[model samples]
Target: MKSKGKVYLVGAGPGDPGLITVKGRECIETADVVIYDYLASPALLKYAAPTAELIYVGKKGGDHTLPQDGINALIVEKAGGGRIVTRLKGGDPFIFGRGGEEAEVLAAAGIPFEIVPGVTSAIAAPAYAGIPLTHRDFTSTLAFITGHEDPTKADTGIHWASLAKGIGTLVFFMGVKNLPHITRNLMDNGMAPDTPVGLVRWGTTTRQESVFGTLENIVERVRAAGLKAPSIIVVGKVVTLRDTLKWFENRPLLGKRIVVTRAREQASDLVKRLTDMGADCLECPTIRVAPPEDWRPLDAAIENLAAYDWIVFTSVNGVKFFFRRLFETGHDVRALHRLQTACIGPVTAETLMGFGLKTDILPENYRAESVVDAFRGQSVAGRRILLPRAKEARPVLPVELTRMGATVDEVTTYQTVQVRDNAEMLVGELADGAIDMITFTSSSTVQNFKALLPEGEPLERLLNGVTVASIGPITSDTARELGFTVDVTAESYTIPGLCDAILAHYQRL
Candidate 1:
């Protein structure tokens, strides 16, 4: 018989993927199967191993992927197969998430399980909207209640009289649809009609929205604002603090939808920076990086490392792939002791430094021309140099080095091929006029992105109002040659530079 498996009941936190607890994330990463809900941030799936089985049991409004009982059965079935299962639910699983029911079922089935509490939206939503649940001057007591109780029951479980008179603050979960009933019950139970109330929707995310009013008029106000379910309702003087404490919604790029056209593996840093600053980044990786068709040339160069005087790296990918191949071939950084290293940018240099090697030359700008200029002062009379980089990279560096009397052997370390996986969705978004800006980080990204566009469509008309941003002049030149209007170009030629340029462009507008 197989040994019994363990189940982890993990709370995935509020809508923000960053809000998840470290332990919860660990559960996701180590689990053999991940069963998640609708409210759980889809981004959290990135933590799961590639081989992990992912099942979505999302229930939103009236639509249900799997009912609560079915979900519980599925969990038991998976865990019974001796697999480590992670049940990922949105918010604090114990709080109105039916987690208690699931846990009880697991206990009856004799399954091993652990509970990982999550950041519930009841508190998180109000906090993100700038409303503190308690204040010394206003109220020091708080209570949490559910908005959607069983309609079939003859009596409500909530004690409205005590809640209105005793509690200093009230937070209701999933209460938007029953806003009128909630407000009326409070007023009827002697709560002041003038009591402040606020509702926050999709809180703690880029799409968070908030509305406020007094109990007497809040239902109408919410209706006029077009608020829906899956919202947090805060009832008390604490709701008034939102006017002075709102921060998340005030970010410079709060609602701007931007597209990032970099390779998927390297897009996270740029995506996080833009997301933190309040831009909703749509990752459309136009190019995918892979090993070259043949590794013999790179292997040969590595085998004869002693003959080279210098090894130059033009991009982060180049440095990583070269060092990786070197290690795979039973060689290490010690073999490069006789060679000087030159990297095009600080990022590439930093990557090289990770291998315990120091860079001899780093250009101020991250382009081939700047690398060539930086090499002007070096003595290259009859010196042998090895250059390992992308197959489609510009030849300016090698050409200029040859002019300075250096015999350069250029070998391909990586290959970048066009990816059209998201092309259809991209064109749909562009046609819908949903994208505000598109960022191009390299010439290859710009080229591949252009190829992804549908044939015979007027490019000018499709991207009419969308701003085009380039990482540097080289990328901007490529965009222009392809008939794209480059609206913003970074002066410093890096990811941070591109972000800063985009921020400045928006600020000026």
Candidate 2:
């Protein structure tokens, strides 16, 4: 007999993907079917298994992809099919997310279910806007009320008089549209017209916007700002604390949409750093790293490791692929016991160290020229050296080393092929002026990204106003040669340095 399936009502948390709880992520990872809402960060969808059937039941203002009743039935059907289902909702599922109704339906259907609580936007939005719901000196009472209650009901479920006189802090979800009604009811119930009010839209995310005023003028302020729904409204003296406690809004790269052109496998660190600094990163990997088609060259070189006196690694990919192939070929780090290694960058050196080998020479600058300069001090006359790196890598290192009387056997450990799957979408985004900046981490990324662009439009016109950032002078030169006007180039050729350069570029603006 087939086992019974379970439905997990998971809270996806407010905007930030990092805010998701461990259990919530686990549920998403293990689910066979995932139903997600509009407010749930699309970034969180990365947690879902690739084979999982993803369904978007996002409801915006009055536009819902699927009605509540239909969603309820869909989850039941998926669960009854013996598939593990995860209903991913934004914020706390139980707090005004209609999750209670869904749970009731699940219970009625006799389906086993679990509730994974998320960080509700009610508190999270106010906090991100620097407004604490309750401060000991300000007030101890807090109440969460729905801003968009049922319109068919004859009267509001909220007791205006009790809220005005009893509560110290009031947070209303989905209240931007009902701002006037909310303010009028509070004041009519004897609440002060001058009570502090704050509205946070797209809170806890890079697009967060905050508007502040008093109950008397807040509606006008929101109107002037043209703020729309999906906003949280805060009413209390605690709203005044925002002026000093504001942090998320002040991030240097906040709201900047940056495109990362590094390989997806290597782009995570850069993406995390940029996201942490408040940039919305789009991982449009221009190239993907793969093993060389013919491993005979690397294998041949590895088989006679004792013949080489030195080994040089160009990048982290080179080090990783070389070691991976080395291990696969039944040889360990001990095979290189006699060879002294030279690495181009600190990251490559660190990766090499992970394989129980420390680089003898680490260049001050992370480039081919720097590697050549580092080797100038060593005795290289008649020395045999092994070079394992990308197939499309520059010939500068081998040429320079050969000039120094060193016999360098260059072998391809990895190949970086152009990725075209997201090319059309990227071109559309670029044409629509949705991208703020595009970052190139290597010469290949610049080359492949240029190749991904369509031919009819002038390259300059297509990328007009889009700031171009490069990891180093080489990559910048590649971009410039391809008709791109480079705006930011990292002083240091590293991911963190690239992020810092992007931040500094915005700071100057």
- Tens digits of lDDT, candidate 1, 1-509: 98778999999998999999999999999999999999999999999999999999999898999999999999999999999999999999999999999999999999999999999998888888999999898999999999987645789999999999999999999888888889988999999999999999999988888889999999999989999977999999988888799889888998899999999999999999999999989999999999999999999999999999999999999999999999999999999999998998888899999999989998887888887888888898799999999999888888999999999999999999999999999999999999999999999999999999988998999998999999999999999999999999999888999999999999999
Taken over the whole model, the C-alpha lDDT of each candidate is 0.94, 0.93
Query: Model 1 shows how many backbone clashes?
Result: 0
TM-score of every model versus the real structure: 0.95, 0.98
Tell me how far the alpha carbon of residue 406 in candidate 2 is from the true structure, in angstroms, after superposition.
Answer: 1.0
Compute the lDDT for candidate 1.
0.94
Local accuracy of candidate 2 as per-residue lDDT tens digits, 235-255? 999999999999999888888
Count the clashes in each prediction. Answer: 0, 0
Model 1 clash pairs?
none
Lowest summed lDDT across 10 adjacent residues in model 2 is found at 147-156
